[model samples]
Target: MSQRERGTRRVVRSVAAATATLAAAGGTLLACAFAAPGAGDGRPVAGPGPCVPGRCPAAYPDPHGGAVVGRDNGVNVFVGGDFAVRGAAAGAEGRVVVEGEFDLAKGSGSPPAYHVGAVGVGSRVPPDNGSPFLRVGGDLKLAAGQRLLAEDGPVNGTVAFAGRQTGTGTVSPKAVRDTGALAAFDGLREELTAASTCYAYDKGVPRKPTGTAVNQGKVTVFTGDGTSAFQVFNAPFDLVAPDGSAQSLSFRKIPANATVLVNVTDENGEARTINTSAVALAGVRRERLLWNIPDAKVVRIAGGGQLQGSVLVGRRSSTTRLSVAAVNGRVFTAGSLAHESGTGGAGGQTIHAYPFVGVLPECGTGPTPDGGHTDTGEPVPFPTGVLPPGFPGLEGLEGLEGLMGRPGAAGPDDAAPAEGRELPREGPPMRASMAVGATLMAVGAALALAVLFRTRSGPGSGPGRRT
Candidate 1:
C-alpha cells in the first residue's frame, strides 16, 4: 500500500469512530429528555411525598391530570362522626382519632380488652413524641371495658378525649381529656370524599387492570403487571369464600414494587358489603395497598377477613360496621362507626398500623366527573387557602421552585420521595444530563467533520489536488 492509500484508510477509521461516539451519546440524550423526571438518574419518578398522604401533582387544575386521591395521613382509624362499640371491638394497632363520641360497649359476647398501640412494634418505627394514639372529640364510654391505647409491654403512647368519660377500663398514662388534637382533621372528611370520587372515576387510559383477577368458585386471584407503577383491581362481586377454611383472596403476578388499589364497587358505582376471613393478603404489603369505596353510604365488614389496605369512604354520614374483623392498614370514614373487633392483640384480630403509601391521582378540590363510572369530568380549581396535607398553598409555592439550576431540588417535573422518605440531597437534573449528552455528540460530530475535511483537502481529493 502506498503512503497516500494508508493515509486514506486512517481517515476512514477516524470518521467511523467519531460517528459511533455520536450515536452512543444520542441514545443517552433521548433518555434524559423524554423519560419521566429523575428516571434517568435512578430517583423515584412518582410516589407519596414527604408529608403524609403526599403532595398533589404540581399541575393541579389539569382536567387530563387523572385522579387525585388523598392519603391516609398516618392515622390508623379516622372517623368523622361517632365511634361506638356494638360488639367485642379490638382496638386499632395504630393511631385512632374519632371526631365524635367513642363508646366501647359491646353488643354481645364476653368483653375483650381492646388495645390501641399507635404505630405498633411490628415492622414500623414507633413515634417518640407523646402524641395520642387515641383521640375522641365527643363523649367517651368504655362501658364493657373498651380501652384506650394503654402502654402495653414495649408500646408507649398517649390518648386525648374532648368529652366526658364513662365506664371503666385501663387508660393510658398520658391521657388528656380536653385538647385540640382533632383540629387538623376539621375538613379532612370533605377533602377525602372528593378524592374518593376522583379515584373511583379516574379516566386515564389503559383500561382494565394490567393484572389478572380471576374469580374462582371460592377464591379470587390478583396478578399484577410488572411494567406499570400501579396495580389497580376491581375486586370480585363476592368477597367471601363460602367455605370457611379457604383463602378468599389470593395475590399473584406481583408487580415490581407496585402500589395496589382495590376498588370494590357494584356496576352502578356503589359500595359492597365486604365480608372477609381473618387471613392476611399474603403477597401484598400493608403500606402499598388501598381499598377505595367512592359512594359508600354504609360500609359493613362482617364475618372475618383481614383487610390489608387503607380504606377510604366517600360519604361522611355513612354508618359502618367494622366488627370482628382485622385491618392491616388505615381506615377512613365520615360517619358513625359500629365496631367490635373479636379479639385484641398482635396475633388476634386487630387494625394494624401500616399507613397507606400508594400513589393515587392528585388534583385540587374537584367534583365527580360527569359520565359513567369511568367518566372524568373537568377537575375543579386548585384549593384556595389553607390547603390540606398534600395540597400546597400560595406561600408553599416557594417549595415548588427547586434550587434554580442546582440538581436534587424539587423541580416541576421532579417527584416527591416515597413514603415520607427524604429527597436526594445532591444529583444532576434531567436537563443537566441532557445537556451533557448533547455536548458530547456535538463535539464528536465536529471532530469527525474537521478530520475528514483536512484529510480530503490535503493532497489528492479536492476541487484541485494540492500536492
Candidate 2:
C-alpha cells in the first residue's frame, strides 16, 4: 500500500497493544481483591467457646445483680449489673443472647487464659456428618430445614455462616469464631501485645514495654457488673514503662464512664486529650458501638431471612464485634470485612443501635442541598456527607482540610509531600524504557503526518517529504 497508509497502520497497532496491556494489568489487580479464595465467600463461624466460670476472690464484692468470670490466662469477663443473658437458658436448644455493658478484661486473674465476654450454649461441629445440633436462644426456629456452620472435611459444609440468617435477634454463623476459645485466647494475646506496644510508644516514653515493671499482659473477662467496684491483688511481677522505669499498677475499681488510659501520665485527661482514638479505645477492652442496622428488625419479622444491613469499615469501628451493649443502639449482627461492627454499651436502649464500626454504607433520606454560598467561606456541600436513602446519618467533619485545598493546592509542583518523600535510588532501566517508548510514539506520529502530506502532494511532492 502507500507509505502514508503503512505509517498509519503502525501507529494504530502500537496504541492498540498498549491499551490491551493496560487492561490486562487492571483486570489482574481487580481479581486479586475480589475473586481471591475466601474473599467472596463472606462467611463467619459460630459463637465463642464455653466460658470457664471463675471463683470470685475475697476482695470481690457481693454480686449485686452482677457476675465476674475469669480465665486461666490474664483475662477476665465481667458481666455488669445491667448486663443480662437474654433469649435462652442453660441446657436448652436456643440462642444465647448477650447485651448491656459486658466487660472483657484481660490479664486480671491467674493461669493467663483468655476470657469470653459472653458465650451461648454451643460448640463448633467437628468434621463428621453427625447431628446438626447447636445450643442457642429459646425463640430460635430453623424453619423446615436449617443448619449451623460445621466442618465436613477441608471444605465448608451447608451450615456455612458466611451468608445471611433469619429470626428476631437471629444469631448467624457469620458472627462465629471457627477456632473456638483457643483461637479467641490467641487473638486476645495478640491484641494485648499490639495494643500495649502501640499505647506505650504513643505516650512518648521510650519505645517498647518493659517486662519487669509492667508486663504488657491483659485480662480475659467472662462476666461484668456495670457498677463501680474494686479488686486488690499483688502482681507476682512488677510493671515497667519503656524507659525501664519500674511502676506498680493498682488493681483499683474502674469507673463506669472513665476508661483506662494506659499510656497517659495525667489521670485527669479526657478522651479529647488523646490524638488517636485507638489509644482512647484501648482503655475500654469491652466496649460497645452503635451501628444503625437497617431492615434488621425485618429479619425477625420474616422469621430470620437474609436481611440487608449497612456496614461501616473504619479503622476503629471495624475491629470490634457486636456485644450486649450495642443492642441498645441497634440490632447488631456479626460483622464482616465488608461492613462495620460493635457491641452494646452504657445507656443501652433496646431500640437504638450502639457502637458503630467498620466501613458503613450511606443510606439517608433527602438530598443535601448545595446552596452555592461557598464564596463566603461557607462549608461546601460535601458529597460524602449525603447518605443514600434509608441509611443512618454518619456524616461528621473529617478530611475537611484536604478537601478545602488550603493544605494542598491544585498545582502539581506546588503540592509538596507532607513529610517523607522517597525517590527511587536507581532507575536507569525504567527511565530508558519510558524514554524509548515516548520517542518511538513521537517519531511514529511525525512520520505518519509526513506520509499523509506526501501522499496528498500527488506524485509531485516537493516540501514536507522524507527521502
Candidate 3:
C-alpha cells in the first residue's frame, strides 16, 4: 500500500483502538451506576417477628428482683451479718438476728428515743444502759454478756442468753434454740443472683439513646415521668438524677402502673451506681421499680430521699454494701447495710415494710424492646446511606457516591433498577474507578506509542538521506 495510505490506516487503527478502550471503560462505569443497589427504602425492616407493643415477655421472671419481703408479714431489717442499733431507734416487724454482737446503745440520737421491737444477739450483748429504752417483743438470744435490763425498761417478751449476764438491761425468759435463724438468707441471696443474671443477659448491651446523652459514657436519662414501660438493656453506666443534685437520681411522676428496670451487665458492673433519694414515684409502688446490679459492690441512696423499688446485690460475695438514707422498699444485700442517718442518730433509720411483687409488666416476656430478641436472631434496621452485604463489587460505593455526587451517566431509568437485580445506586468506588481508568489510559497510550515507533522505524521513514 502507498506510504500515505499506510500512515492514514495506522492513524485510523490507533483512533479505533482508543475508541474501543474508551467504550469499554464507559460500559464498566455504566454497569456500576445502573446495576448497583439503591439505598434502603427507608421503611422499618422486619426484625425477627411481629413486635406488638405488649406482646413480648417480661425481662425478669420475677419482678421486684425476686420478692425478698412479704407485703404484710415481713422483717423491717434483715441483716446477713452482724447487726447494731446504736443511738438509732429501729424496729423490725419480724425477728432481727445479729450474726455478730448486738449493741443497742444510743449513738447520736436525733429522734432521742432508742428502741427495738425484737432483737436476737448472735454474740455478746452488753448490759443495756438505763438511759435509752430497748424493747423486745420476741425472745432475745444472747451468746454472751449480762442479761438485758428489763427491770425499768419494758420488756414485752423474754430474753434467752447463751452465757451468764449481769446488768440493768431487762432479761426475759431464757430459752435455748437453734442459732441458725439467719440461715434462710443464704438461699434468698442465691435466688436473687440467678434472677439478676437472667435479667442482664436478656436485656443485652445498652446502646446510646437517640436523644441527648450526658457525660462521656453510654447513658440514657429520662426526664419527668418516663415513657410507659421503659426498659434499659445491658446498661453499664451511671444513671444520674434529673435535677443533677449531689448524685441524687430522681424519678418523678412515674405512672402508678409503669415499671422501670435497669439491668446492668457484669461487663459494666464497675460503672453501676444508682441514687434514687430524690425520686418521687408519684404513688407508684416500690415493687414496680427494679435495679439488677449483680456485680455492684456499693449502692448509695442520698439523704431525705425515698426510693420505691427493689435492689438486688451480690449473693455469695461479701463485698456488697447498700448505703441509704431511708428505704421504703426491700434491700437484699449479701454484705453490709449502712444507713446514712438524716436524723443524725444511730440505728434510727426506719425500714418500712414493702415486699417486691414481680418483674415490671413492660419488660415483656420475649425479648428487650430495643429490637433485640433471644428467640429469633435479627438485628435492627440499618441507618440511611449504608448498604448491607449480598451486593457484589459495589462495596464502598455508597461512600464514593457521597463523596462524588451522582454518576454523570446515570439516567432517569437507572433511578430504581429491576427488583432482585443488583445495581450500584451510588457512583463507582473512587479508588477502583481511578485504578481501572488509569490502567486503560496507560494501555491506550502504549498502543499509540508503538504505532508511532513502528512507522518511524520502517523503511524510508527514519532520518531521510538513503542513497
lDDT of each: 0.49, 0.21, 0.34
- TM values, all candidates: 0.58, 0.17, 0.42
Pick by lDDT: which candidate is best? 1
lDDT of 3 by residue, 365-449 (tens): 1101111101122121111111123222222322212211121111111023345865333454444555544554544444444
How much does candidate 3 score in TM-score? 0.42
What local lDDT does model 3 show for residue 5? 35
Query: Quick one: ranking by TM-score, best first?
Result: 1, 3, 2
Ranking by lDDT: 1, 3, 2
Q: Runs in model 1 with CA error above 4 Å?
A: 1-73, 107-109, 118-125, 144-149, 167-170, 203-208, 242-247, 267-271, 278-283, 303-305, 341-348, 367-467
Off by over 4 Å in 2: 1-196, 203-250, 253-256, 262-467
lDDT for model 3 comes to 0.34
